[model samples]
Target: MFENLSERLEKSFKLLKGESKITELNIAETLKDIRRALLDADVNYKTAKTFTETVKQKAMGQNVLNAVKPGEMMVKLVHDELAVLMGGTSTDINLKGSPSIILIAGLQGSGKTTFTGKLANLLKTKRSKNPLLVAGDVYRPAAINQLQVLGEQIGTTVYTEEGCKDPVKLAKDGIAVAKKGAHDVVIIDTAGRLAIDEQMMEEISAVKKAVNPDEILFVVDSMTGQDAVNTAKEFNDRLDFDGVVLTKLDGDTRGGAALSIRSVVDKPIKFVGTGEKMEALDVFHPNRMADRILGMGDIVSLVERAQEQYDEEEARKLQKKIAKNQFNFDDFLKQIQQIKKMGNLKDLAAMIPGMGKMLKNIDFDDDAFKGIEAIIRSMTPAEREQPSIIDGSRKKRIAAGSGTTIQEVNRLIKQFDDTRKVMKMMTTGNKMGKMMGKMPIGKRR
Candidate 1:
């Protein structure tokens, strides 16, 4: 995500290293570096200036504790300020209206249609709401087709008129359909242009007035930098959107749009598109984001993602199996599937404290687990249940079936055996059971 900005900010914080306490001269030097780092990250000039000044004011006002180092204190101040700069906290989308209607608006190529599908998937999977997607991009036939494909992929209903050119009418009709179908949420995906135009603005405004949507989200490509902020301002002036959606955020290293859009439009960022999958959307959390940006990791968000895939009954069964030293390849395969469902592998790893910097030069494929899954799947049910019985000849056969080498099979078996021993130990003293009890799983937010 904000790889470059993170690196820059870390270096700026190093200016206070070894300092016994804060001082005007030392703080000025650190603030200068911080300001330059923000500018290099494509942050708005005005926003950056205001942010540094506010951070400075707070830094100077702090009564540094004898136990806290100057570098540690400065980092804390900057981290809190960064969180405040990104809207201070997360904001939930309004869905109080019966068959709550949401309007999606943005410039073309901003991932509006994809975000629509992702939002529907989140509502359906996480919130337990029946959502209907409306293809309101009447100017583009391809958009309608795209929406249909996404709707099919996510198992949601999509409303569309074959040849209708009026988006306002499509949205109204779509809402009526939602009410008839007893859907709890209706998301209308509006059309976008290559650039801002009067017709685009007026058409979206008309739809907003007609539907009186409970929420209007402005999607923007985070990689567009300051241009994204400027475009958001223009849209807010016309539509007064309820929240902002930063798309392609996983691909944006500078993070200018995510940092500046809130300050420019004064709208909380509701969601961020982390990847291409329908499950890749995440509720925006400013404090967690600040943690990630400052190399502190976001353990809370990471645990929440794990909790989403955690099944209490399944975990209980798995615990019993492990207690009896019965954890097998089939069990291991299921665990991998649950982890894969959590989201991108690299993104999940980055949530661990200090892993972001360690993984800076490494490339993580989303399919990193494919080889292990294939190897496990190639095993016979007997072999999966009792891996210790596999001999040399069986290893050759399994390796050939899995398109892997015998050495790979040997490595996997060794790793599995080692893991089983550790799990057995955890279960021996009821340690694993106690940890599971402490986890806040199966709880509604």
Candidate 2:
């Protein structure tokens, strides 16, 4: 998302590459480059100026250790300053009160309704809270239907008053329904205008007054750039929102809204929408985001995603199968499915250290595994269990069933065989060493 900014910042740091320590004279050009990078990313000019100044001040004040290069020290200083610029720590939504109410506010087409559904899904699955989606967006035709569809997809309940034009009444009644039904959380999706208007603002303000919500979230489309930050300020001035939610962060955005909104509006970004899926919502962590923007990778977030898909019992079973060389196509397919559930493949890969830079120019499609999956699905149960059973005739049949070439099938079989061999060697620690020794002298450790 912040690809251009990351590259520019890297180049800026290179200005100090050969220097032994950070000095004011050498740091000026680097700061100018950093400020230019932020400005090019659509950041507010004043915010960018202040950010670079703060970073420069910090960099000049710190004593560089003998082990730390000047370039590395500058990168760390900028990373810390970036995090401070983007709300130093993550903020949690206030879910207090009986049947906690969360009011959603934003401009039209900001992905407000979509984020509402995602928040409900997160609450239901992660927090174990029974959340009721309140379709309070009375102006937009089919808005209730959209919320209902999202609720159905997420297995959550949607409360709607089909003909009700008064959002305040709808919000109040929605909370009442939630209380009666014992729903732990009520998320009210209010109406939004294409542009800020008096009528729209008043209606939402009246609803906020009526509901007295525990948390008010202002949803913003990060791709809107500085416009997003300006809109967030207007919303905060009117509704005094508790936090911000940046949507469509996975798009080709400059990331100005995420970096500048907090400084401008004095609000924390509670969550970020990474993809279109309901499961793509992530708690906004400024430090981790700073790391990602600097091409340092977000290993903590990567581990968290892994933990979300981890199952202790399943891991033990997989370990036993690997040890016995019984990890077949079925098991391999299951592993692929688990990885798919962890959000976008390219995004996941970017979470690894140094992988983001390697993948910067690569267009990684999430469906890259489609061919392998199709080939495996076309296999018979016996063939999947024992891949060795698939010979020349079976390969042709499987190729036809999967809409792939016989050569492609052969390639997949060879890849699977190689993977199994490597896995077997891993399981047998001594065997891995023996295999390495068999390689040419120069190639072997």
Best by lDDT: 1
TM-score of 2: 0.94
lDDT of 1 by residue, 262-369 (tens): 898899999999999898899999999999999999899899989999999999999999989999999999999889888898898999999999999999998888
Candidate 2, residues 1-445, lDDT tens digits: the string is 8989999999999999889888899999999999999999999999999998898888888988999999999998999999999999999999887999999988888999999999999999899999999998888867788999999999999999878898898999999999999999999998776446988888888998898999999999999999999888887888898999999998899999999999999999999999988889999999999999999899999899888889999998987898899999998999898888888988989888789989998998989899999999999999999999999999999999999999999999899989988887777888767877789998755
Q: What TM-score, computed on C-alpha atoms, does each candidate reach?
A: 0.94, 0.94
Model 1: lowest-lDDT 10 consecutive positions: 193-202
Task: Please give the lDDT score for candidate 1.
Answer: 0.92
Q: Which stretches of candidate 2 lie over 4 Å from their true place?
A: 430-445
Q: What is the lDDT of residue 267 in candidate 1?
A: 95
lDDT of 1 at 440: 88
lDDT for residue 350 in candidate 2, whole number 0-100: 87
